[model samples]
Target: MHIGIVGAGLIGVATARELSRRGHRVILVDPEPLSGATHAAAGMLAPVAEVTYDQDDLYPLMATSARMYPDFLAGIEADAAYRTTETLVIAADAADREFLATLAEFQRRMDMECEVITTRAARALEPNLGTAIAGAVRIPGDHQVDPRRLGSALLAQVLQSGGEVRRTRVKAIEEENGPILRLAEGEDLRVDHVLVANGLNAAELVDLPIRAVHGDVIRMMMPAHRDHLITSTVRAMVQGRPVYLVPRADGSLVLGATSREDDLTGVSAEGVFQLLRDAHRILPSVWECEITELTARARPASGDDVPIIDRVADHISVAAGFSRHGILLAPIGAQLAADVVLGEGGNGPLAQSVRLGRFNHSPLEHSTRK
Candidate 1:
């Protein structure tokens, strides 16, 4: 089957890769390719640290995806040689420290393995930490991947598998027994199946209540902190707000992120300042690192903050609404979507709930993606 894929972010690329692996011809359509949230993301596969109020459905999917990372990265890293290791979540302030304490207790109650260390012990793990820091929690299962490298790796895999990638924006999908997609400049292409994996643009295709939530993050080029197991993902609440500092193997520290619901994608000075201020508060030693770049990207947020991954029709399917968990859910989302497209049944929970037509109650009857 010839499959049409919209958007070339991580999800799109992963979906295309999965389909191609299953011997299906894939045509990926996107303008920027990997330069979306997948580009700006810190690439922390931390479902535990990322847990909020009470979203248990997402955790199962996240854990499944997180478990899949080992094998996924093994193949990608064998080709790309990107680093994947443990991550640390830290708390520097009093209030934030208390929050970490609560998180630690919750982890204990849940029978999860995480370590709560003192300020000195935390500093021992990350020597750059500020002396005024309170303490930290280490989640060994939480890992990191270079998003840029991962994107490049996935794109390489797709191209190597004889998949076609078009650098054009897909405007809409037309149904003709199967599905036909309309690209930029009024170009029309026909395919046996169509999948929408573009983050925010999927909403425009389907009338889902998905909106883009903007987050600004700054990347700094600092001294290489490899060889040391200070390798846990560190996150803390700086000044009554949540902030995270993710360290890379190549001595780069990703300091992020400020959540703004505005639709703007431009990197703002204020956003960079907020990241720097939080980074300084969390780890004062990073103040000397050179500011490499500041980036702002919107994460696709749905009403329930969970992805909808079901088919809209026999030939048309949607796979957006991943929000911040796109990276964590990429593998399962792509695999299940590919299985569905290939006429293989799927028992995945996400495949059942992420339907494009699930939320429509208007007079329009069914959801349309044209």
Candidate 2:
């Protein structure tokens, strides 16, 4: 089968790679591939640490994708992107500590590995931690990854596997004889199946209850003397807001992510300041790092915050609304989408759990979601 995937973000690229590996001819369509959320993501693959109070349904997908990371990266020969270092989620104040403690209790109740540790114990694990922390929890199963590296590796493998990447936007998808991808440039190409793995832009092609949730991320280089400043990922709750620091393999740190549903598309000043301020509370040595880059991207968020993966049309499948967890969920999202387009009859991909039909989706060719 020949498959056309729209929107070459991390999800689209991963889906293309999955389909290509499954012996399907694939054409990737996007104006800019990795420059979207894939480029800006901090790549913390922490399903345990990232859990929240009201997202029970999302845990299964996250855990499944976290488990799939090993084989997923290995298949692309990009195992170097996966980092096995564990995660430490700390609290700054008494209130923050109480919050994390309560959350940790909830986490443990769900059979997740969460150990409440004293600040001293946390510092022992990562000697460079600041003393200002009030409490901490060790999530040994949580880890990190390099999303940019994974994206580049996947894109390279797709190209090497005889998959075609059309460096243009897909104007529309019209079902003439089949799913015909009307390109913004060059001639239209028809494929047996079309998958819309685009981020929020998937809304332009297909109707979904998706909105843009923007986040700002900062990249920095640790000083020569302080290489590997913190060996593990650091997450903290300062006051009531959340912040995290993800260390890369090459002594760089990713301090990020302020979630906002505003119109500011570029990097946010307040967001960067909040991240740096909160990060300093966790690791005071953050000021010693050289600022490298600041990026902001909008994550496609569905109404339920869980991703929507389903066949909207007989020849079209849609996978979007990863929210901010796109980096953690891409592997499963890609596989589930592949399963949908391949006409697989099994229930392996949890398609029933996150399909558009959950919204009682009408036929795509007949109507669009309002």
Candidate 3:
């Protein structure tokens, strides 16, 4: 089977890699691969730490994906950027500690590993943690990866396996006889199935109610003397907001994330200040690092904040709106998406959770097609 996939972000590339390796031809289309959220993501595989309130369906998917990471990375030979570093979620004050304690309780009840440790224990583990920190929680299962390197590796492997990647935009997918992909500059390519996984942009091609939520990420290089200054990813809740510092194996730290649903498109100065300011409350040594990169990108989210996976048309399956869990859910999401595109039977709980019928989505209204 020849598959046409739109959007070359983590999800698209992962699905393309999965299908192509299984002897299916793949043509992935994107104007700028990884220019979306994947380009700016600090890949944190933290199913336990990222569990939010009332999102019951999400934790299962995340946990399943986290377990699948090892085998998946080994399959692609992209383990260089993968790390098993533990995560320490810190709290700045008494109120912050209480908030984390409540969250940890929920995590524990869900059969996930979350150990609440004192501030002293946290400082003993990292040694460089801020002295004034109130408390911390340890999650050994949480890990980190370099998104840029991992994405490049996935794309390279797909190419190595004889998949084709077209650096052009896909205008639309029309099904005259089968699925016809209308490309830029008046070109049309037909395919057996088309999968759309291009973040929020998937809305334009299909009736997915995906909206853009922007986040800013900053990269810094630790001082030469402080190599491996922090081995564990440190996430904290300062002033009721969340910020994280993810350390790479290369002695660099990624400080991020201010969630903004505003119309601002560029990197928010306030967001940067919040990350740096809030991060300092947990790891004061961040002041000594040199600022390297500051980036802002829009992550996709749906009305329910779950991924959309269903065949919206006869030969087109849509998989988008992963929100911040794009990298974390790639392993499982890619395989499910490939099955939907290939017409393979799948009625598992994970599949039912993300079906398009949950949203009551209106099917493709394009009358010119079919």
Candidate 4:
């Protein structure tokens, strides 16, 4: 099969690699690959810390993808620089403590490996923790990865595996006899299958209910003397706002993020202030770190905040709306997209949870090729 992937972010790259490895000819189309949400993401694989009480169905998919990370990275030829570090979920005050305690209890009931510990124990694990913390929970299975490195690796592997990557934007997609991709350069390329993995842009090709959820992230480099001040990922609730600090391999830290619905402008002062303020409350030394980069990107999200993986047409499959879990869900999402393209039924619970039919109707019916 000659598959045309419309985006080169984490999901598109992953899908391209998966399809290429399976002996399919893949052409990834993107004007700026990896410059989208994947670039700004912290790449934390913490399904436990990310789980919300209302979204229990997403947990299984996230956990499955997190568990598949080691094998996934090993299979790739390039070094993605994966890191398996436990995450410490901390609370800044009494109210936050009670909220986390309840969350920990809920995770425990779900048979997740979560331990509620005192602030002293949390401080013992991360000595740089501020004294104002109320409590913490240790989710040992959560981990982290460098999404930038992963994207580079996937792109390299796809190219090495005889796949083509076109550095061009897709103007439109029309299906006359087969799927014909109209490029921004005024060219049309026909393919056997098309995967609309273009994040929020997928909605432009197909009438899927994908919206952009914006988030602001900051990258900071720790001082040479205090390089390893915090070794593990720290997630905290500071004054009812959620923030996290993920320490990278090169003595840098990623502090983020502020989740908003419809603000697509550049980075805002309030978002940066909130991130820095909450991060400092968790680790005071963060205030002394040098700010390297401040980025704002929108994650593709559905109305229900779950992924959309379904074959809307015979040769067209849509895989978008990963929301904030794009990095974590890449492996499984790629597999599911490939399965859909190959006409293999992806009937798993995770696949069913994100199937397009759940939206009550699909726009593909109106857009199908005659």
Candidate 5:
């Protein structure tokens, strides 16, 4: 089967790789591959720390993907530079500590492994932690990965598996004979199946209930003397604003992010200032780090905040609305999309769980495609 993937972010690349490995011809189309939300993402695989009380349904998908990371990276030819570091969910003050404690209780009720520790014990693990922190929750199962590396590795795998890559934006998709991908350069290529894995731009091709949720992220370089300053990912509720610092193998730290729905106005000064200020509160050493890059990208999100993976049309499959969990959920979502493309019948539960038909109205009603 020849498959056409409309996005080159983590989801598209992973889906292409999966399809290519399964003996399908895949052509990934994207104008700026890996430059979207995947590039700005911190790549923290923290299903335990990321669980919200209201979004219990999303935990299974995230946990499944998180568990698949080791095998997923093993199969990829290019190294994605994954790290199985534990995560520390710290609290700045008493109120924040209570909040995390409540969350920890919920996690425990859900049969998740998490340890509530005192500030002293938390500081023992991370000595650089500010004295003002009240408590922390140790989530040993959470991990991190380099999304840029993952994208590169997936691209390499796709190419090695005889898949094609077109460095152009898809103008539209028409289903005359099959799915026709009208390229931005005035070329039309028809394929057996079309997977709309593009992030926020997916709405332009299909009438999916996908919207762009903008996030601002900051990348900083750790000084030579302070290399590997924080071994594990640190997520804290600093004055009720969620901030996290994910350290990379290259001695760089990713600090982010401010979630603002429908705000496409790039990174702002206030966002940067808040991130830096909260990051400094968690680890004071961040004050001396070199400010490297400030970026913003819109994550494709749905009303439920869970991903949508279903066959929206006879020849078109929609895989979008991953929100901030794109990197974490890419493997599973890719497999689901690939299964749908291959006409697999046993994926009924998986398909129904994220099916677009769950919505009241068809996404086609809102599609911008001609």
Candidate 6:
């Protein structure tokens, strides 16, 4: 099958990689390089720490994606020869500790395992964690991939596998005999199947309920023991605010993020300040750290806060609405879409729950609630 993916973000790259591997010709369409959420993401493949209320259906997909990452990263690392890192979720307050305990309980309900530890034990594991921390959990299975590295690797893998990547933005898509992609340069590229994975811009081509949720982040160089600063991901909820510090393989630590739904235009000074403040509270010595980089991007979110991975028209598929789960769910979403493109006509319950048209029926909406 010939598949045309209309985005170069993580979803598009993953889809291209998967489709190309499955003996399909995939043409990747996007003007910007693979540098959206994939570049800015912290790349924590964690489902237990990212859960919310009334999102049971999402857990299965997230769990499936989490289970898929080891093999996915192993394949990518073998192809790209990059280091794969582990991830951990931590708590800085008693309330957050309790919340995480409840969260771990919820995960166990889904037949997942997470190890609990005391604040002192957490600091012992990662000595840089501030003394104010209450407790932590070691989810050794949750891994971290450098999104930039992963995107570049996947782009290389896709191209090497005979997939054609066009550096052109898709203006619109129309279904005529098959799906026709209107490029930004006014060139119409037709293909057997089209997948919309353009993040927030998904609303432009189709009336998707997707919106951009703005997030601002900052990065800094790890000062002392830079190489061993953090062996795993450290996340903390300090003073009721969610802030995480992800230490990369190169001694660069990413501190993030702030969620703003009302404003999607750009980064807010207040948002950066809040993130820094929260980060400092978790690691008081961070104030002495040198600033390296600052990033701000919007993640595509939907009413249900999960991703949509279903067919729109006959050959047109919409794969946006990742909210904040794009990186964690990309592998499975791409493979499932490829299956759909190959004429396999079935979506699992979770995928059906996230389909674009699910909102139209409105029959009790168990998927939305569960």
Give TM-scores for every candidate, taking all chains together and pairing residue i with residue i. Answer: 0.92, 0.96, 0.97, 0.97, 0.97, 0.91
Clashing residue pair totals per candidate (backbone < 3 A):
9, 0, 0, 0, 1, 1
- The regions of model 2 sitting more than 4 angstroms off are 360-370
Clashing pairs for model 5 are 207-363
State the displacement of the C-alpha of residue 358, model 4, in Å, after optimal TM-score superposition: 1.0
Q: Which stretches of candidate 1 lie over 4 Å from their true place?
A: 77-84, 223-231, 348-350, 353-370
Q: Which prediction has more favorable lDDT, 1 or 5?
A: 5
Model 6, which residues run further than 4 Å from truth?
77-88, 224-227, 361-370
Ranking by TM-score: 3, 4, 5, 2, 1, 6
lDDT of 6 by residue, 1-370 (tens): 8899888898888888888877889998888866687767877777777776698768878888877876776656432423345455667678888888888887777767677877777777778777777778777666666778878888889988999989988877776687788888888998998887888877677667777888887878877654546767778777578888887767778888688876546668898899888888777867877887888888888878878777666777768888888888987888777766675746568657776665663212221111
Across 252-370, the per-residue lDDT of candidate 4 in tens digits comes to 89988688875665887889999988898899998789998999999889888789988887778889999999999998888888888887754878878879888876686554422
List pairs with backbone clashes in candidate 1.
87-232, 87-233, 88-232, 88-233, 88-234, 90-235, 308-354, 309-354, 310-354
lDDT of 3 by residue, 209-273 (tens): 88899999999998888767799999999979999999988889999878999999789999999
lDDT for model 1: 0.77
**CA lDDT scores, all candidates in order:** 0.77, 0.88, 0.89, 0.89, 0.87, 0.76
What lDDT does candidate 4 reach at residue 41? 96
Determine which window of 10 residues in candidate 3 has minimal summed lDDT. 361-370
- lDDT value, residue 301 of candidate 5: 92
List candidate 4 stretches off by more than 4 Å: 75-80, 365-370
In model 1, which range of ten residues has the least summed lDDT?
Answer: 360-369
**Model 1 agreement with the true structure over 1-370: per-residue lDDT tens digits:** 8999988999889889988988889999998899999989988788777776567667777877888877776667432434456656767677888887897887666666678877777777778677777767877777767778888888899999999999998777777676778888898999988887887887667556788788898888775443422355678877567788777766777878688886567986777777778778877767677778888899988777778776667777778888888887888778777876776865656666655545652312244545
